[model samples]
Target: FIVGTITSGYYSINSYDYLHKLWLRQLIITSFHHALGFLPSYNILSSFILRWLGAHIEDNVKLAEFQQILRFPSNLLNIEHGVTTFGRASLTSFTMTKEGLCYVDEIYLGSDTNLGNGCTIMPGTTLPSKIIVGSLTLVTQKYASAQSNCVLLGIPAREMPFVIPDDTSVINDLSSLNSSSIYSLLFVCLSFFISKYLFIALYLSSPVAVALFIHAILFCAIYQYSILITKRRSHFTYSEVITHQQYFLFKLMSEFSTFIGPYLSGTQLLPFLFRMLGAQIGSDVILPDIRCITDPHLVNIGDYVRLNMGAYIQAHTFEQRILKLAPITVNHRSVLMSNTLILPGATLQGQNHILPWTLVMKDDQLPPNTKWSGVPAKQVP
Candidate 1:
């Protein structure tokens, strides 16, 4: 009987240890992602000095150079031994907070994953190799398992999985994929992003659009500031913030950012531009500003879909309670207008429209032919 009791105790300890490790991983990942966002603006001389002071830099994860403030919380952990370059970018990390608690560990970046301007990566993520992450994307979760060469967009990124088979490798005929092809692709992207109706249509009616823009901005600024204060006053290190319910809050915030930001971006020109400029965007969708994606390789945007201004779309959040993967989709020609938030694992079909100031829950679908508006947005006419 004693032996059995001892064995049971051992098992319990083992389970606790496992949970601890997971918590640690979560904390580490969260800290680096948050802190890196605020670091990009430091002058090279400053970055060098910081590095000389033993700053933890991750490999293949480059921070942009134009960042203004750099804040790494106390609980920062398990950073890889690699060079993180900073382009023109601003960086900021949250202070330890009661509301944002979770443990994080190592941030793994596949070779050559670049972080664009103003992009923020939250803790506990793994980015695959050779991916171009757009600017201003808020990334959270473990995406190390994502297929290489995929593109991710928005706050909570949805991976658009695409494979360039070995059979079609360019080395066999590198000349076939010449500079013109690259330019053509660039033109298509540029035209799609910069089309007159693309971002301009939303701005055509400037007054109401400006009001909505201000509303969205104020909401985000207030919320973000609150989160920052929570982090700073708590005395939690980057790693310590993810310990309890706070972890869940960050997960919620990350998911909320993903949903709200993209929904807002899906709106008309002004509001969309504001959110897109403020948040990170990945690869899949066409965003007005290229600098918004933090990890582009892990995002997927559907063809002919319009993410109107102020739309927030997210793919994944905290893995401790339940591992989740939620992606937002707008079918061909479907429009998700300003301030529309789509939660994890949502699907919207073509010709379907989500009107302004709407919030969509998880695992929900919008009928293709209808329009949805208002809080908890539902079909209207």
Candidate 2:
């Protein structure tokens, strides 16, 4: 009976310890996301922040360069050593089911691989060596294990039939970045921050600092507390349009992400944000401003797609009191040029290009590999 009591007590202690550590780690990561510090040398923030989150970062990985966009949420990552890549991620998921519950998990990038600009690596993925993932590639599907020696490109991320070249250029390009110059920028920003704040502290008798500190603390507390109450399981559906409940959750997350989005670029963050908000955004796709994202829960975008500046893609419209809801699917390698407007139910197929000032009508089906133009867009020969 004594042995049994001791074992039970030991297990209880272990459980408590685990939960405590998890909570602390989650708090730090969550706090970093909210800070949205996007100074010229914000990479410093990502480097230290990732280290604190138990990520194994290698020298000159340059992953920190994406700190403005990439996030390593504490509870959702377990990165290993020897990774070399230039890409960002919406990577988070532990476990999942078809009924839609996601448990956070590690998303890995194998050593000597490169995910080029506009590439999106989804959660629950493990890539192996000597691979090159092309720009705007969407990795929406889940891979249970590591894949090696392949090139994945385009919407839906199909493997190229031929073996692509290895990524030696990612390492060779470091000299062009001028790290010393970047360090100088960091120093200037740091000095200015300290000087400005120190003068305020002294001139204002420090009470202002105390009040501001208290206010910040209260803000953080309220923000975290609200998130807990609206806690959601991160998951994406393959097809079906999101329900009202999913819509509400995603919209709330969008507001939060958007508030902090401008401090840093959303190139690396928008996909995750849209997904969290019930939009089916594919891998490696680079969207323009999402401020024009109307009815995001009904939107779907394919891999390797690009949205030029001033593009407005909508999924819902109202004619008087009557409301219409439909899905917009922009397929792989498509381009929506500046000032383009895609109304509800428009499906743009592979390699389609919409010229500037084009306005696609509702339920329009754009043919593949064609260039379109005009107010009510038509094929341009």
- lDDT winner: 2
Instruction: Compute each candidate's TM-score over C-alphas.
Output: 0.30, 0.40
Q: Report residue 316 deviation for candidate 2 (angstroms).
A: 34
- Per-residue lDDT over 1-381 for candidate 2, one digit per residue giving the tens place of the 0 to 100 score: 101101101112235432344334345545775344332221333544465545555434434134422343433344433343332324432234454433334566665555543456665567776566654455654643355777675555667665543332332222433574466456545654654464445437758647544433433343344334223422222112222233333433343345445532338566665675567888997776656565566788888988877777876542211235678999999988876778778999889989876768779998899999864577998
Tens-place lDDT digits, model 1, residues 200-312: 45446567658456544544554454345333332222223323233323332343354345554433442334343343322244443222332222234455555644455
| Model 2, global lDDT | 0.53
Q: Which candidate wins on TM-score?
A: 2
Model 2 alpha-carbon drift over 4 Å, by segment: 1-34, 39-45, 64-70, 75-88, 93-96, 144-147, 166-381
**Candidate 1 whole-model C-alpha lDDT, 0 to 1:** 0.42
